[model samples]
Target chain A: MVSAQPAGFGHDTRHELIRFENVSKTFELSDRTVRAVENVNLSVARGEFVVLVGPSGCGKSTLLNMAAGLFHPTSGEVYYNGSLVDGYNLKTGYMTQNDHLLPWRDVVGNISTPLEIRGLARGTREARVEQLIDLVGLQGFERSYPSQLSGGMRKRTALARLLAYDPETLLLDEPFAALDAQLRLNMQIELLRISRSLNKTILFVTHDLDEAVALSDRSVVFSPRPGHIRHIADTPLPRDRNLTTLRHDPLYTRMTAELWDLIMPTLQETRGEAS
Target chain B: MTNAEIGYAPASDEKVAEDRKRRMDKARQARTRERVKLNLIRLLMIGGFFALWEFASGRLIAPFFISAPSAIFRRLGGWIWSGDIFYHMGITATEACAGLLLGSVFGIVVGTILGRRPFLARLLDPIITTFYSLPKVALAPLFILWIGIGMDMKITFTAAIVFFLVFLNTYTGVRNVSRELISILYLMGANEMQVLRRVVLPSAITWVFAGLRISVPYSLIGAIVGELMASNKGLGALLVRAQGEFDTAGVFAALVAIMVLAVIFNTAVRLLERRLMPWKSAEQELEGAV
Candidate 1:
């Protein structure tokens, strides 16, 4: 099936990027039980940019984190390319909400960290690092430490780090939630462009509806806190999607409105509204 | 704003900017190299101090109580050549090395276990802290009595001193690990052993190394104290015998030997730490910014 996809399948009909098979997660907090995610079943295809969007405290981040191997479901399995994920395989790169850059490393060194961990030769690592640094528009900031870089620059460096290792899949858990509005917009566009160009599968988590619409092939709207899957809305945006045109599309508005309606009731329920 | 108004200048302008950047980068590299050179110079200054002290004592001042550097070197050279220095150094080294190995091993294993397991951490918290806080050096006489006037006494003394430092550092390391990081490792399919080896050990190594660096000097002190009280062959015993006979120069020479050995050992440990922890710099930089 995997070999057939590369040779015969249409670009959109490529093999599933990741599959969550009957996943459930539970937590025992001081004898007080909490069911975090209940029976989530979904499959994301190769090169698809999927966003798990919901209000804060929902299991959106948890779902994305599970895909990153940062959290395991209490039951069921997560399969990548039809193989079960049992441990951190390093094949999928994860970007955390807070940019977890090692402060002592310079921008180029930070980007090349996974290569260092994999024990790549210095000469090859340096060449790859330079390529990533330039791709992220951090060419001049190679020697600068994370401490010296602005928040936006740090995030950019982190993104470069994610791309440096050429992971087939990328999982982002509210990666740009800490950025200001303008920077977030810029980053979202860059991220989308990079994802499409690299043809990498991405599972991005966010609470912002506009961001989900802006970047995702499909946006999965989740229920509020201790979430269940509410709806998965697919956008007919092309692989070469653009921000300027997305806002102009009537279809974008229609899908966003549908997802917003799904989220509104859940938000009201969490807020204990009489309605 | 228009693209031109946003100052999307020609590629040549950007290339010029890049050239300036290259120069600045070279300057920064040079500065870092200079800083390392300065640290080496400071090390040489310390050596220079001992040389001046030896020359002034032997030539200018009376050499009765103060030993000349040359004289001390000559004595050290004879001792080394004839293997007498090795005998004394070997005794103290054996005690210190054994005690350090046993104590650090016990501390890391026990400390990490207790730190990770909440029930155990809570159960032993008070008792562990109390014993750790108490100065074990003062109990050297008691240890000598317990283990008899042999190498056992020195080993026990060194072990007692080393244990608490390593235990506290390792405990702090395990306890301070990022909760989010652990969850990430688990989600990655890391089992208990993998988590310990990949996550816990690496996370705790900085603290364990810190503890090791601190406890090594204490190990030396503990062994010396044990020798002073009862041992017949270690460096401490040599110093005691020299002092009893009013051979102050001999005592000073012994003290100099210990200092040189200590400095060498400490330097080697620091070099080992640098090789092991390539990740440490990033963490430090993050902290500095915070």
Candidate 2:
């Protein structure tokens, strides 16, 4: 198998950008305790696009939250760039299912939040914001509030806001699941383009097998509740790929089918439990 | 040539334009007729109310006790002509405004603090509720004893009344802020103060405005009750004095003045809300459409 390595890459051994060392998280509910994730060990390489796929309530989001330092693992530690993460992982940008855009702020204002927090100069911030607006195709909506934008447009604005901080790593949680199919495809393509150009390390969580196969260099499948890594598979598809024509690729089809096979039992188990 | 070829057939574009115009005209006429009917009914209802009040005053009810609408109007006119009504109005307005400003500031500050700190909010919940349950009017006599029978007593009473209402609403508003948004802000490297200013305050502002709207009338009620209990100034004092002298018309006139004051305060608060939250109007319109 030919290893698809871009030029001027693959020599550095310090590729571990984010690492979870025997991490586990448990939530204490009012009446009982729920073990969300159990003894999960995962590592994301620098500039690697990794996707986490699992059934509902599988602690996929919990794993990402641990990486972002929003939630501390109960027993073990999460490390970023070889440093223990005690508080918020400032080097990473996190996006959840909800856009979480400030409704009071206009598009530019929302996108410029991180810059303002960092106390960037007015001219520089405005210039960067304008560039992002163009990049996200939200040029004419600079002054429109979140309520005024369409669902797809709001998601784009959120992406722009996430990028504004220029974090080295991104933690995205089903960011495109709320969008319709066409819009979702468009966003996925845009995300891939941006991720490549920026060369960001991404740990994305999604329930869609096709999305995972299409976007990631390595896809991690998680088991249902008390989530553990069930399988970690490397995509055979080349890095230079077109998202629109991805499904037609034989290799892409096989990868998605394999993922579906791996996740179907857990999905059925959940259905069984519900019934 | 056939008749169709000789241009005797109706022109399609002209006919369509004429039909559209006729439909629009009919719609406009119907709207105008409906509006006229509505206004006529409203006027008749108001006229009928006054006529009945006049008819019942001296026959079914005693004029000396209930007083006639004409007599109340005459008393009001006399006060206005003498310019004594303005003095009473000025005093009441001052007390209410002072109390509202002070109460709102205190409420927002304390409410925000308590809202941000769940432990503190929970700790004080029982005590706060106990105080909140106490009728604010009952405090008027206590305020008079402490502050003495002047504008200070009325202002203090009004502030106490307005404070509790505003505080509860602001607290709920802050608590109800979106957890997702707060988490996002924290991930963005915002400290506690930044999160409060940039996210929490803005998110809770609508609830704060709602509280402000509700507190305006309560502020007036507090001031008037304080004055009625014991004061030498304000419209409430005037009403008390009129009752003592058996001037039923003067008492009715004072009540009318208080109603006008409520309307004015409500209008001012609405204007302030519009100015502060321009985004809320768009949000409301979206909600209305949905």
Candidate 3:
């Protein structure tokens, strides 16, 4: 909503932030053993928007979860900042599909939860939480509970919560998948603007090819279950590009279409190769 | 598609959506009304039964085995005014209250210690459950022998009843908390105590409330049963004395007093629950009034 520098955000320079070295995950169910991810070697760079796209049960989410330190890899190591992640840390903020805001907490309280967890002084935390409320365009509804807000508003509140801690890296799990088509586009534009201003590294998981191309600097496509990389594509779109200019980019359509094509074959292959 | 053709489909979709929403609203209203009606009927039925008891004992039936509601009230009034009921009520209340508080504290501490440590939970779960399952009434003689037949026996019995119910419920509640919620909190830089304080405790509140509701009744039952086994002053002792002397009216009166105490305690606890959980009402509504 406010003007910010655009040129400085567009650089394609990469710095290694997180690296996955031959990571694999296996889950044991009552009657079956499922390998959710398999030898997935991937790395996310600082200040880069990395989107992981695939179909259902693609292990894309599993791979992301491992990177988030939600699950331990069965075989390999995930190094963040050149060190293996031991347990959960505040340095990486994860926003799940469901906005896990406590019902008892109002918008301001929810947004400041990370700060509260860190045990920041009440006065400083309150001031920063108010700033976040304004930053997210949620000024008037600071006192509203999650139940009282609309779908888009709740997502914004959750995003605000993620941003309040100002984590070095952000992990999003299909954050806008629940919104309507029009609202999803609006949110995409807003997310780009915020991400640009913050210059934070983000790893986003999504099913929509258009979303991946429109939002991410590079897209990693996963194969099927026990997911491995099918292909990785880099988009030429600038970091400051919003939904309007992103859709109008000459290379945008081709990038999205190519990703769709790459993923479609895997979907079909997985189905056929299964029972 | 032209605007004219597209227009009708969208319009119909909107109307259908609106109709469904209206129907849903009506259904919610109907359900709320039914809940209110059920509560009112329950209250009226209780009152009506009391009135019928008064009428039967006073007029048609002989007031021998079953005392009239009016007679019980008059007897209660005399006992209270003459300060005779006060000592007995005080003894039972003190034993029940003391036992409940101490037992609940121990139960929560033990339950929490076991719940967080999975290996410990596994090792001690069977033993704890076995103790819980053993007939509580059978423990009365053991408690009497150990505590020597005074208020200590009553308190021990009450404690025994309150402890297991609370321990089992709290243990399950702690176990039932979502692992994801814990991880999220941990990632937010919460320490172990904070995770337990903010996440586990709040998640367990509803179950703890349920356990409290159940244990309060057990507290009263335990005290009364202990008194029945051996006590000189309590409603249970009064009932035993009345039965030995064939004072059926006195027995009925003592039972009625116990029921009244239970109803009052439950009502107070329900009020406390409502105060503690203002968020639960909104959450339930979002779950579609079910």
Give the best candidate by TM-score.
Answer: 2
Please rank every candidate by TM-score, starting with the best.
Answer: 2, 3, 1
Error of 3 at B271 (Å): 2.1
List chain B TM-scores, each candidate: 0.80, 0.83, 0.81
Candidate 1 regions off by >4 Å?
A1-14, A69-72, A75-77, A103-106, A143-145, A244-254, A273-275, B1-156, B179-202, B209-221, B231-290
Taking the candidates in order, what DockQ does each have? 0.11, 0.25, 0.26
- Model 3: how far is B272 from its true place, Å? 2.2
- DockQ winner between candidates 1 and 2: 2
Residue lDDT tens for model 3, A1-275: 02111222223336788887778889999999998877777777788898989877878777667777888899999888778976674578888788777666678878988888888999999999988776656766777667656666788788888888878888888999997776576667667767777888888999889999999998888878867776778887766565755667778988988998988988897888786
**Model 2, B1-290: lDDT tens per residue?**
22233232223323433454465566667778999999999999999998999899999999888898999999999999999999998999999999998898899999999999999999999999999999988887787778798898888888998899889989999999998788888888889988999899999999998999999999899888888888878999999999999999889999999999999999999999988887776575454232
What candidate 3 gets wrong by more than 4 Å, as runs, is A1-14, A139-144, A273-275, B1-44, B54-62, B285-290
In candidate 2, the residue pairs with backbone N, CA or C atoms under 3 Å apart (3 or more residues apart, or in different chains) clash, namely none
The 10 consecutive residues of candidate 3 chain A with the worst lDDT sum are: A1-10
lDDT by residue for model 3 over B1-290, one digit each (tens)? 12232121223323433454565577679889999999999999999999888888848887886877777778778777888677777788788888888788877877777778889999987887798789999999998778799998888889988988888888888998878778777777789898898778777778877888999889998988988888888878877987898766667767777787788778877888778776665455445522
Model 2: per-residue Cα lDDT over A1-275, one tens digit each: 02212121222336888887778899999999988987777778899898989988889999888888889999988888989998788888888888889999999999999999888999999999999987776766788778767777788899999999988999999999998786687678778878888899999999899999999998988888888778878888988788777878999999999999989998998788678
The numbered model that scores best in lDDT is 2
Candidate achieving higher TM-score, 1 or 3: 3
lDDT of 1 by residue, B80-125 (tens): 8989888998888888888888888888988799878989999988
